[model samples]
Target: MAPLLLLGLLGLLGLWVLLRARTPAPGWPPGPRPLPLIGNLHLLRVSQQERSLMELSEQYGPVFTVHMGLQKTVVLTGYEAVREALVGTGQRLADRPPIAIFQLIQGGRAWGQAGSPWPTKPCRSSGAWWTSWSSTELFNIYPRLGALLQLHQPVLRKIEEVRAILRTLLEARRPPAPGPGPVHSYVDALLQQGQGGDPDGLFGEDNVVACVLDMVMAGTETTSATLQWAALLMGRHPHVQGRVQEELDRVLGPGRPPRPEDQRSLPYTNAVLHEVQRFITLLPHVPRCTAADTRLGGYLLPKGTPVVPLLSSVLLDKTQWETPHQFNPGHFLDAQGHFVKREAFLPFSAGRRVCVGESLARTELFLLFAGLLYRFRLLPPPGLSPGGLDTRPAPAFTMRPPAQVLCAVPRPRTLACSLKTDGPSPGP
Candidate 1:
């Protein structure tokens, strides 16, 4: 009994020593006191990390340290702090912090080299992963534990599946011989670049495949999530829905599909869509790392400090927004009812590492959103009241809308047809 008690005391002392060594360097910003091994994970509350971080910001100020598992991260909150760190810091805070799964998939490279095609491949696979909150978070914090528990098998399998699918697509689209040609498709452009035009020397077979996977995955998920939120918000706020439909009716009028140019004419509808992105704040934080020693928000961050420019805090910033928590389309509209673009409206984030798909995403959101609202009066399921419909996000890699039935009650102008989740069709 005496020997066991002595060993236990020694273990406690060792833990104290380990935690002392884990303390943030002197210049790092203030933060909540962290516990052993887990760090400040308890304060973050896992699923609602964005809100938790925002709450912590109130305690620690704009720039503060938060330990996510063993990883020491500096979280930049509010519009001013996030904007300054992201936009003002130049390339000093532009690098992405390495994730275990990405490192594993990239064969230990810190994600793919930059170009037009490398923001979100595995993120796409992350959807197919369908990993629950506990397991995925655990995997992120302790990859070795996940491997010990067999959590990585699904991810490894998905990697195989993505590669296999890409191989099939590439084989189907491979030219009879490599030669000068008009770019017919995404595959052709990549093949052409690999053959000669790759200026950065990045488009080899492995990198090209990586690029294509990213393009395909990046192509779908984020835009789809935004659209899902737009539809949900429309159901929840029918007054806003009516206003959008009214704009779509006056401007679009059923004869034509929503084109990119139609956005300028449809101000209310555009504002509503922008509000959807702001309110939900999906994909709230993507961690970035300091390439060199950087000073931000009056704190001197050493090299490689993982920084989170909290996009949610920016979107919900009380200083920049009139009704920060509410779904107000007027936030993007002026007194005369013309659509106004606010500098604080940074749904695609800002700066050097801003989302690569920003332009494409904007066009897609406008066209798809306008077209959907034009045809359908989105409604809550038969039993659920619009007021009672769940606005709470389901836990996933994103702040995903809760799965609930919605009725696409068609408007009088559009012909009734079978609705599908795929791309739009021309006729009834």
Candidate 2:
């Protein structure tokens, strides 16, 4: 009876060892100890993951590992570590973690129906990106069962909604024939890639949904959010606003849309735009997993380990920026007052995983920002001093400026030309 009891206890201990997650490798970056399953989640604040990671970097050095549930992530903070991982050995970290949800959704089907009708007008594109950990959690359960019992109901619904729109767009964009036909858009390029034959079925409706969603987010939310930050910053710092406006007036003038080429001529305006992107720190980063077993920042990161190149850290590093905490356009300006590029200004991120729409984003930002400042003098709402405008970041998908009203009073150049025999003079 005593022997039987001891054997049973030993069996239970063996099972526990097998079931628990493996401990970190000998050379893996050091991190706070993780419990049986929760990992270092207790060390983090809700919705403040970026800040939490920054704090951890201070304690554990620029590169360190932390377990978020069962997943071990390698966080690269500061300019040197981030640049080394992203730019130095980018190919090693190019692959995105495969999401089973993406593969499971379409179940091996080409999205665009042959010879289908295209929408007469383009559909409004929109989508949302829930935290990756949520998706990672789904991997543990049966995909089908998880779908039925998914906690993120609104996000699941949004996925379907975005997919429906993408399906329509794919049908519209698919070339009648896959070869030498006009590749009108990104969807067309994707369709052409598959036309050659996707043995792995890599280019299909499922991937198309992912690709289109990427475009929607890049083109819409990020661009719009950065512009919102620009406007808010303009309203808050009137001197900065005035300088940008002065540059815009001298260069683009009224009613003339800012051409991409005008970025060269509008130095201060360009500086302000660059500074806005750097200061607001939009879309801190999308985690990229190692494509191959890679060593980063003197640490061995196994393949598929999520690597967060905390762009916000790079943007706010005291060593990198003259005043990382403040919104100063001079960060991009030299003593000569000419526009200069900062090596550490990585708003769009770096490496192969960099934003595809960066040039488009920059162009769009210059056009909209220069156009708005050229046409109007953005001011704080009545009774609010310019200094009173809040610069505190409102947390969201991006570090968005707090919601508030701003008055857009037209500039002198944008005012309509008066008729020779107009009625009464306009009241001041």
Candidate 3:
């Protein structure tokens, strides 16, 4: 009886070992011990979540895995790990994980569509979209079931509302007929693509609406948040602000708008923009999934494994920057005072799934930042000294500056004003 009991226990232990081995592929990266069902969710706080992730990297090394709920997530930190997977082995990591929230808001398709009736219009927005991790907890269960059963009722409702708004926009923009029309706008191209059986199947009406909604959301928020940061930073660092205005005054004197061609001559201003992106380093991580079984940073990642390339790690990599934590524009400038681009400057991320609005964002950043600095001398609010101002961003869906007020003192500039146009001046 004793011998039989011992044998039974040994068999059970063996089965347990086999099941544990099957969870992750051999040579899988190390990570924090996750609790069942919850995983590492308890370890995270809503505030400064990226900072918490960065701290975790120190304990587990750059490339490591953590379970969020029941999902196994691989985190790639620093420039080497990020570049290797995103850029060097891009194609294999091109596919995105099926996120429930995106599907709910956008529709069945992920991106652009073809041969649509709607003509694309110019994007106009000053703000960026907000990020939320609430959806992640739902990954443990079926997406539809979780979305329906979970407590995030408002979120689900908002997704539906956004979709409805997008549908209305699509209807409004739809052209009466389709032909060799103006194809410059995004909507036009998407409409054109939806015409026939697209080889990639990316040109459906649903997909087009999703793509347009994404752009609209991006245009409305992220850029605006970034410009807000620029204003705050300029106010805090008056010397830096002075330098930018001096360049503008010299190169783009009085009433002349700064053009794309003027970028070359305004090296310092360009450097400041680059430095601002580096300092802020929004979107701490860019999410990707393995298209096929692949190895990353010496770890075997099986097909469909969710991966997060930690962009913040690269942006603040000690090995890459002279002063990783400091707000220094010299990082983007050479010793000769020329604006130099750095390989580590990846605010919009890299590889195939990189941000599509990068070019537009850059143009907007330069124009907005320069234009503001040209006319206004941003000053720190009363009772707050420049040095005393807090540079830390609020812990939210995106890396946004803390809520505070600043004075945008108008600088005396030639406005090309005509006194005689309206009426006779009042007698003094």
lDDT values for all models: 0.77, 0.71, 0.72
List of clashing residue pairs for candidate 1: none
Q: Where in model 3 is the C-alpha error above 4 Å?
A: 1-25, 112-145, 192-205, 388-390, 413-428
Best by TM-score: 1
Relative to the true structure, candidate 2 reaches a TM of 0.77
Better of 1 and 2 by lDDT: 1
Q: Model 3 over residues 50-119: C-alpha lDDT tens digits? A: 6777889899999988876667889998988888888988589988876665555555565531111111
TM-score for all predictions? 0.87, 0.77, 0.80
Looking at candidate 2, what is the lDDT of residue 39? Answer: 69
What does candidate 2's lDDT look like per residue over 1-428, in tens digits?
A: 99999999988876674456455568889888776455676676544568888999999999998876557778889999999988989589887654444444334333321111111111122322123233323332235555666633434455577678888988877777657777677777788887768888788677766666656644676777788888888878999988887777777665677888988888889999999998878767667789888999777777788887899999988899988988899998889889999999998888786776778888988888888888777877768898897776654445556667777777764443221111111111
By the TM-score metric, which is better: model 1 or model 3?
1
lDDT string, candidate 1, 159-199, tens digits: 66778889888878777776788898877888887775677
lDDT of 3: 0.72
Candidate 2's C-alpha runs over 4 A off are 1-24, 99-149, 169-184, 187-210, 413-428
lDDT order of candidates, best first? 1, 3, 2
